[model samples]
Target: MFISFEGIDGSGKSTQARMLADALREAGHDVVLTREPGGSPGAEEIRRLVLEGDPDRWSAETEILLFTAARRDHLERVIEPALASGKVVICDRFADSTRMYQGLSRGDLRAVVDQLHSLMIKREPDLTILIDIDPATGLSRAKGRQGTEERFEDFGLGLQEKMRAGFLALSKEFAPRFRVIDGARDPQRVAQDVLETVQAELPG
Candidate 1:
C-alpha cells in the first residue's frame, strides 16, 4: 500500500510516519520510508531551494512549479519503483501539501494545482492520514524545532491558521482515503490509532 501523512508543521505527522514504518518493519513487512521534496537526489536539491531562504523567495505560482518538479523527480526515482516491487511506501508529505500551501496560501488557484497535477504528476496515495491539530499549538511546536526550513513557519500564526483550515477542508474534499486523527494527545496514543487505521487498509 502507498501511504502519505499530511498535517501542519509540527503536527507529529513526520514522527507518526516514522513510527508506522518502524512498526510495519517489525511486523515483517517490506517498507520503504521516504519523504517528499527530499526523497530523491534531485528532489533533495529542490527541497533546499523551496524550503529554505525567505518566505517571499518564490511566489505561489513559482512554488507550485518548483514543488511539482521535486515531486516528479521523487516519484520517478523513489516512489514508483518501490511500489512496483511490492514494498509498502510511506511518504511524509505529497501533492496535497502543494494543493494547500501553495494553492490556497496566497489565493484560490486550486484549479491550477489540479491542472498541473493531472498533467504532470497523476499519482495519489492509497491512504492519506491527516494529523489534525490546533494552529497555535502546531505553530508553537514547529517553532520549537528551530530548523532551517522555517520559511513556511516564518509566515506566522495567521498563515498557520489558514493552513489548518485548508488541510481540514482537504480531508473532507478527499474523504474516502483520508483519515482524520487528533494529534493533540500523547504520541503513543496517536501512533496506535494511526497503526490500526493503516492496518485496516493494508492488503491481505
Candidate 2:
C-alpha cells in the first residue's frame, strides 16, 4: 500500500506520517517511511536547491522541472522497491503537493506538472490523506517552529487559501482515494484520525 499525506506547511504532516508508520509497525506490518523532494540522495541535493536557494533565481517552469526531477529520483530510489516488496509506504508528501503548490495555487503551471506526473507516477497513491488547515493558522504554526520561512512557506495567506481550495478540489476529483482531515485539532487527535482512516482503508 502506498499512502501519501498532503498539507500546507506546519500542518503536522511529518509528525503524523511518523506516527502512522510507528502504528503500522506496532501492528506487525512492514513499512517504509519517507518524504518527497528529498527522499533519496540525489533528490536531497535537488531539495536543497529548490527549497533553500534564491527565490529570484528559479522561474515557474524551472521550479516545476526541478520538483519533477526530485520526484523521479525519489520514485526510482525509494518508493517503488518498497511497494514491490509488499511493505506499506507512507510518504510525507507526493505529487499532489506539486500540483497544489506550483500547478493550481501558485504558478498556473498545471500543464507542465501534469505532463511530468503522467509520465512518471503513472500509478497514483492507493490513498491520500489531506490535512486541511486555515492558511493563517498553519503559517503561524510554521513560523513558531522555524522562526524563519522558506520561499514557499513565505507565500502569504491568499496563496495558502487558494492552495487549500486546490486540495479540496483534488479530493472531490479522487473521491474514495482521498481523505481530508481537519488540521485545526490537536496533533495527537489528528494523528489518531489518520490512524483510524488508514486502518479502515487497509483491513487486516
Best by lDDT: 1
Give per-residue CA lDDT, model 2, range 70-186, as digits (tens).
989889889999988889999989999998888876567888889989997676899999999888888787767873227777666777788888889999988889999998998
- Note the residue pairs that clash in candidate 2: none
TM-score of each: 0.99, 0.94
Model 2 TM-score relative to the real fold:
0.94
- For all candidates in order, the CA lDDT equals 0.95, 0.86
For candidate 1, write residues 119-170 as lDDT tens digits: 9999899999999999999999999998999999999999989998999999
- Give candidate 2 misplaced runs (Cα > 4 Å): 147-149
